[model samples]
Target: MSVMELLASRRTYRRFEQKAVPQDVVEDIIEALRLSSCGANRQAVRLVVVNRPEDVARVQPLVKWAAYLPPEQGTPKADELPTLYVAVMQDTSIPGDLATDTGIALANMTLAAWAKGVGSCIMGAINKPALTRLLGIEEPQKLAFMVAFGYPAHKAGIVPLTEQTGVKYYLDEHRDYCVPKRSREEIARYL
Candidate 1:
């Protein structure tokens, strides 16, 4: 698929099939992170790959799911959990834009995953302290985000934003994700 097509189809995926992601795909995701550009090339971002089923299960509860919808509709069932989790962290000892670096790395990783037919969700609303402890993250390293990945079980797509639709993403009647996006004309201006 073309890059634009890939970008358009790479929506945030919450519900996933229980099938495991291939090891090569997981490695590619990590490699994407490793090669992602960072401010000043500090490359302060660190990662912890939770590909083992048991370890993935341990990390699941510590990370929250979609916030726009109620838990019943947004959270995945036990059988629908992601097969992999990659914890994004920042090395405190290396000073840089943590947020920007993490964002770049995540975009690269997720895009790479999607290109390989894997779905992903970048999670932020999580039990950070507990996760840090559970993942054995130490000083000089701080957990920033968790990315869940697997084969998607549901579909998600962009919907035009209307007066009634506001901006929050919602589950359609079919339970597929409907993310409302403002038109380019509404958000951009030509110089």
Candidate 2:
């Protein structure tokens, strides 16, 4: 698929099938993160892969799901949880903008996973202290975020925002996601 197509289809996936992403795909996702561009190439970002089922279960509760919808509508059930989690970290000892680097790494990793038919949710609303302890993250390494991954159980698609629709994403009658997006005319302009 074309890059634009990939970007359009790569929506945030919350509910996932109860299956592990292939080991090879996981490796590619990590490699994508490794190769992502960072501010001034400081490369302060790090990762902790949690592919083991037991570890994934332990990490699940520490991270929050979609905030736009109610818990029952947004949060994935036990059987719908992602089979893998990758903890994105920042090496505070290194000097650089952690937020920029983290965003680049997340984009690369999530796109790679999506290309291989694996879905991902980039989670930032989390219990940071507990996750740091659980993942054994030491000084100089701070938890930036966690991304959940697996084959998607539900479909999500972008919809152009209308007067009736707001910016917030919502679930359709089928529980699938409808992510409303602003039109280019509204959000961009020629100088």
Candidate 3:
């Protein structure tokens, strides 16, 4: 698919089909991230791809999902959990705030993953201290965020928003997901 189409269709996927993502595919995604725009060209980000069942399982509990949804609806069902995780880390050795760098790398990886029919959820609500220990990452390397990847199990649709309706993602009565986004006219002002 073209980049525009991919951007329009790519959604934050939390519920995933029970299937393993190939290691090479993960490698390709990381490779794309490696070449992504880095703040100051610091190249401080490091990604640890976890595809092994045991490691994926270990990483799952460290992540918290869907803050807008209730506990029951927010958490992925047992069979719907992602099979792979790309743990994005910041190498403090490079020296600088990594927010922009991390965002660029994640955007690249998520887009690349979606192009391959893989869906992802970039999670910031993580148990960082615990995850660092579990992953055996020490000083100078900090877990920034994680991107969960797998085939989507549920449908996510983008819906137009109104002033009265705040833009928060929610599940419809049928459990289908909807994300409300502001119109371009509301967000962009041409000179």
Candidate 4:
């Protein structure tokens, strides 16, 4: 699919089909992230892959929505269990620009996952101190994202909004229960 189509199709898939993504495919996604632009060529980003049941189980202790997310229209039920997880991080050795550099690489990986027809949800609601220990990340290294990947279990459809809706939160609208977005004008700004 074209870049526009891919961007339009990207969704935060939490629920997933119980199928394993190929190891090579997973590697390719990480490779794409690796090739993405890095701030000052700091190349501080580190991607940790989790596919095995044991590995995924370990992450549950680290992830939970920071708070109850609002109900969204036409949003699909994310698979509580994802077969794969990618943890994006940055090396501490890089000085003065960890956050910005890591963010760019994280965005690249997110888009790359979408381009592959794999759905992902980026999580920031993590216990940093615990995660750092859980993932064996050392000083100067930080976990920036916990990305979940899988085939969607629901058929996401266009989600509408009202003029009064200030935040662009999605919801389950279609009867089939897939999560799709509405037109760009409803969410984008030209300026």
Candidate 5:
């Protein structure tokens, strides 16, 4: 699919089927991330791929998913959790904030994952300190965010920004996950 089509179809999927993402595919995704542009070409951003069952189980609780979801629909249940996770990190030795580089790497990985029929959710609301400690990530390498990946078990679609469809995502009565995005006209204008 084309880049615009990929972007248009991409959505943050919380529920995933019980399937495994191949090691080589994850490696390719990381390779894509590594090839992405970095600030000053410093390459401060790094990734930790966690797909093992034991490690995935340990890392699951440390993440906070879908902040906009109501209490009744909070966290994903065991069966609904992701099958893989990519921990985005920044190396402190690089000597600058790597937020932009992190974003670039994440975007590359996300698109790559989507192209492979894998769904993803980029989450920033993670318990970094606990995650780092659990994953044995030391000072120089600090966790920035995480991206969860798996074959989606539920559907998510976008709608134009409107009062009926506010900025936040929600599940309709039929349980369809709907994301509301601002229209181009609302986000841009002639110079």
Candidate 6:
């Protein structure tokens, strides 16, 4: 796909089909991240791959989601839960939080996974201390982000709405999906 097509196709895929992501594919994505543009070409990012449902269950409690989306339609079966997790970390030696930089890396993986018929969910707002303990990460550096990956259990598509439009994607009382976009003319400004 073209660059624009790829960008438009990307989405945060939280649901997953019942399958395991090949180790090599996960490795390749991480390899791509290693070559991503860092602050000073410092590849201080670390990724921990988790592929066990038991581990996912253990770690799931520590991860949180934005309130924007309703609770998931349904949870995957014990074995069907996403089995791959990429833990994005910032090195202590670095003098920065690396959140944005790491997000870029996660974004790369998210898009790349979608391209390869995989799905992913970028996670934040979770319990950091608990995740640190669960992942056995002892470095006092930083925890930039975490993402879960696997075959998608749901359809992959876009819900387009720019900031100029007041339309928003929100959940209804019945836990249904809705999108309300604001007209561009209403919010656009001429300087």
How close is each model in CA RMSD to the real structure?
Answer: 0.8, 0.9, 1.2, 3.9, 1.3, 4.0
**How well does each candidate superpose onto the true structure, as a TM-score?**
0.98, 0.97, 0.95, 0.79, 0.95, 0.78
How far out, in Å, is residue 48 in model 2?
A: 0.2
Q: Which stretches of candidate 2 lie over 4 Å from their true place?
A: none
Model 4 residue 55 distance off true place after TM-score fit, in angstroms: 1.3
User: What stretches of model 6 exceed 4 Å from their correct place?
Assistant: 72-80, 160-191
lDDT of 6 at 191: 86
Ranking of predictions according to lDDT: 1, 2, 3, 5, 6, 4
Mind giving the per-residue lDDT tens digits that candidate 4 earns over 1-191? 88877766776665678777677669777877778776667677788888897887777667754133433322223444677888888777776577777677766777776676677777887777877787787766777778777776655444554564433444344423333345678669898
Model 3 poorest 10 in a row by lDDT: 159-168
Model 5, global lDDT: 0.87
Which residue pairs show collisions in model 2? none
3 or 4, greater by TM-score: 3
Pairwise lDDT winner, candidates 4 and 5: 5
State each model's CA lDDT, in order: 0.94, 0.93, 0.88, 0.68, 0.87, 0.69
* Residue pairs of candidate 5 with colliding backbone atoms: none
Off by over 4 Å in 4: 66-79, 157-161, 173-191
To one decimal, what is the Cα RMSD in angstroms of model 2 from the true structure? 0.9
Candidate 6, clashing residue pairs?
A: 16-153, 17-152, 17-153, 165-182, 166-182, 167-180, 167-181, 167-182, 168-180
- After best superposition, candidate 3 residue 27: deviation in angstroms? 1.6
- For model 5, the stretches where C-alpha displacement exceeds 4 angstroms are none
